[model samples]
Target: MESKEEHYSHDHIMESIRNLSENDAKTFLNLIYALLRDNTLPSEQLVSHVLSVYEKKIPRVVKTRQNK
Candidate 1:
């Protein structure tokens, strides 16, 4: 079961998309679905985590592991 904060309504996501270019928004959506399919987290929770991870550590994650 997801905690209350992990869930987002369609309107909420649509609001976020409102400022995005159609091409950017489509790419964002494709990445969302990819995360949902690739990660083990629930679809709802995975979306939240994906946003969090992207906002935080995505660059570090993409950097060479050999550097660590």
Candidate 2:
């Protein structure tokens, strides 16, 4: 279970995000995307890992090391 302080922290962060102007939100997301793009890992493998962890299910078509 999440602690009260942790919940409040997430809530505060979300509230701050919600208060951003539309343009600011877009720019923030774009910057995050740029950082992700600059990583050494392949994008598809990163996506597969994220889905497997968060969704608790294997991706239908994960990339193999041999494919690289």
What TM-score does structure 2 among the candidates reach?
0.46
Residues 19-57 of candidate 2 have per-residue lDDT tens digits of: 555775576667556556766668887675443322221
**Would you list the clashing residue pairs of candidate 2?**
none
By TM-score, who's the top model here?
Answer: 2
Query: Where's the lowest-lDDT run of ten residues in candidate 1?
Result: 57-66
Off by over 4 Å in 1: 1-16, 42-47, 51-68
In candidate 2, how many clashes are counted?
A: 0
Kindly list the per-residue Cα lDDT of model 1 for residues 1-68, writing each as its tens digit. 43434534456444444545577557666776788778987768877777754442332322323245
**Candidate models: Cα lDDT each:** 0.54, 0.44
Which number leads on lDDT?
1
TM-score of each: 0.42, 0.46
